[model samples]
Target: MNVLIITAHPEADSFNSYLAAKAARVFEKQGSVVNSVNLYSENFEPVEGKIFYPDRQDSVRFDALREQRHHWEKKILPDDVSRHIQLLINSDLLLLHFPFWWFGMPAILKGWMDRVFVYGGIYDSRQRHENGVMKGKRALLSVTAGAPENACGYNGRHGDMRLMLWSPIHALHYIGYSMLEPYLIHGVRGGLDGIAKKEQQKLLDEKVEDFENRLTNIHEWPIIPFNREDDFNEDKTLKPEAPEYSPFVRHDPDGWKKS
Candidate 1:
C-alpha cells in the first residue's frame, strides 16, 4: 500500500509532528511505501488568487471553477499544485495529521485541499462523490483537540466530534475516498514548564504508541459509511428508502423549515 502522510503544523518538534512521524514509521514497518507532505515546513500556499494564473482566461476577474478547469486542461497549474496532484494520483491512502483548530483542520491543510484538489483535475461535475476520479482510494484523519475526549463527544461543549468533522468527512467522501473513522486525542494542553512538561512528554509518548496500534490494525479499521448513487433520487435528495448515514442527509425538505 502506498501511503501519503500530510501534516499541517508550524512547530517541527511539536507533538503533532511527532504523531505524523510515528505514523510514517508504523506504515513503513508494514512494508508500505510512504510519502509525506509537511505543509508548514514546505511553505505550502493555501490562498487562491490570480497570482497563480498569469495568462488566465480573464485577467481581471478570477473564477476558480472556470480557471481551474482551464488550467487543468491546458496543463498549466502552479508548480506546487501540479506536484501535489501528481503525488495524490500515485498514492492509495492519505493519512492526515493535524491539531483541531477552530473546530476543523488548520487553514494550511484546508488550503492544500483547495489548491491541490483542483476543480478540473481532482474533481469536476461528472467526477465526484461515488463516481469521483479518486475512487478506490482510502483516507484517514488523526486529529488532536484541546478538550477532553468526552467534552468533544455527543453532549460535550465542543459538540459531536463526528459531526464537527463533517467538513473534511464530506469533502473527502465527495471526492471518492473510503473515509475511515478518525482517530482523535483530546485533553491536549500546552506544557512548557516544570512537572507539566514531564507529564506532557509522557502523554505524548503514550499517544504515539496508541497511533502505532491503530496503524498496526489498520486493515480492521472501519470505513465511514456514505450513500451510493442509487441512494439519491433524480432531484439529488436522499431516497426515502435509503439509510440516513449522516444526520444532515435526512429525507426531509421541510426539516430545514422546522429548524
Candidate 2:
C-alpha cells in the first residue's frame, strides 16, 4: 500500500510533528510505502496568484479556476503543485497531520489543498462528490488541539469538533476521498503549560499507541459520514426524505437522526 503523509506543523518537535513521524514509522513497519511532505520545511507558497501562472488565458483578469485548468491542460502546472498532485494520484491512503490552528488547518496546509487539488483537473462541476477523481483514495486526519477532550465534545466549553471539522471533512469527501474517523490528540498545550505533566504524558503515550494501531489496521478503519451524490437532489439540496448525514443540513431542533 502507498501512503502519503502531509504534515503542516511549524515546530519540528511539536506534538503533531512527533505523531507524524511516528505514523510514518508505523506505516513503514506495516510494509507500506510511506512518503511524507513537511510543508514548513518546504517553505510552500500558500497564496494563489498570477506569478505562479505566467501563461494565462487572459493576462488582465486572473481567474484561478480557469488558470489552473489552462495550466493543467497545457501541462505547465507549477512544479510544486504538479508534484503534490502526482503524490496524491499515486497514494492509496493520505494522512494529514497538523495542529488545529484557530479551529482549522494551518495556512500552509490549507494552501496545499487550494493549489494541489486543481479545480478542473482533480475535480470539475461534474467530477465532484461521488464522481471525484480521488474517489477510491482514503484520507485520515491526525489532528492535535490545545483544548481538553471534553472541551471539544458536544456541549462542552469548546464547540463540537465534528461541526468545526465539517467544512474540511466535506471538502475531502467532495474531492472523492473516503475519510477515516479523525485521530485527535487533545490537551496538547496543557502538556507544555505544565498542567498535569505526568498524566498528560501518559495520555500522549496512549494516543501514540492508538495512532500506531490505526495505521497497522488502516484497512479496517470506518469511514466518516458524508453525503453521497444520490443523497442530494438535482438542486444539490438534501432530498426531503433522505437521511441527514450531518447536523448542518438539519433544520428541526431535534436535528439529524442517526443513520
Candidate 3:
C-alpha cells in the first residue's frame, strides 16, 4: 500500500511532529511505501497565485490578487494544480496530521486544502452524479488538542471536537474515500512538564501503535457505505443549528441594556 502523510506543524519538536514520525515508521515496517510532505518545511505556498491559472501564462503580467479570488471560486485548471494532484493520485491512503488550533486546523493546512484539493482533483461540477477523482481511496486524520475530552463537549467550554472535522469528512466522502475513524489525542497540553512528559510520550506511542495496526488491517475494516440520503437529511433541508459564534465575543453592555 502506498501511503501519503501530510503534516502541518511548524515546530520540529512539536508533539504532532513526533506522532507523524512514529506513524511513518509503522507504515514502513508494514512494508508500505510512505511519502511524507511537511508543509511548513517545504514552505508550500498555500495561497493560490496566478501561477495556478492556465489562462495567466505570463508570470510577469499575472495579478496575485485576482488569482486569489479566482482560486476561491475554484476556476483554475488541472495542469496548473498538477503537482499536488499527482501526489494524491499516486497514493492509496492519505493521512493528515495537525494540532487543533482554536478548535480548528491551522491556517496553513486549510490553505493546502483550498489550493491542492481543487475542482478536478477532488471535485468536479460535471461529475455531480458520480464520484470524483479521489474515489476508492482511504483517508485517516490524526489530531492533537490542548483541551481535555470533557471540555470538548456541548456543555463544556470548547464544543465537540468531532464537529470541527466536518469539512474533511464531507470532502473526502464526496470524493469517494473510505473514511477511517479519526484518532484524536485530547489534553495534549496536560502532561507538558515534569514526570508527565514521560507519560505523555507513552500515551502518544500507544496511539501511534493503534494507528499502524489499523492501516495494516485496512482491508478488514468495514468501508464507509455510500448513501446519498445520508449526505443530506430529508427531514431537515437546512441545518437549523445556529452558526458557531467565535469564543472571542465583543461585549457591548450598552447594546444589551437597550434591548
TM-score to native of every candidate shown = 0.93, 0.94, 0.73
TM match of model 3 to true structure: 0.73
For residues 170-249, write the lDDT of model 3, one tens digit per residue: 66766667777777888777447777878777876787777678766767765444344334345623233323222211
lDDT of 2 by residue, 1-259 (tens): 8999999999988889999999999988889899999999999999888899989899899899999999999989999999999999999999999988898888898888889889889999998877899989999888999899999998788888767887777888888998898888898874254558877898999989987887788888988876677877888778777786667875354654442
Q: Distance (Å) between predicted and true CA of 178, model 2? A: 0.5
Error of 1 at 203 (Å): 4.3
TM-score, cand. 2: 0.94
Model 3's alpha-carbon lDDT is 0.70
Task: Please identify model 3 stretches exceeding 4 Å from their true place.
Answer: 57-81, 128-130, 220-226, 229-259
Best by TM-score: 2
Relative to the unseen true structure, what is the C-alpha lDDT of residue 38 in candidate 2, on a scale of 0 to 100?
A: 96
| After superposition, candidate 2 runs with Cα above 4 Å error | 190-195, 251-259
What does the lDDT read for residue 194 in candidate 1? 93
Using TM-score as the yardstick, the better of models 1 and 3 is 1
Tens-digit lDDT track for model 1 on 1-259?
A: 9999999989888777888899899889899999999999998889987788866898878898789889889999999999988888899999888999888899998988888888988898888988887799999999988777788988888787878899988898888888999988886778568987787778767888877997999889999989898998899988789987777788775774574
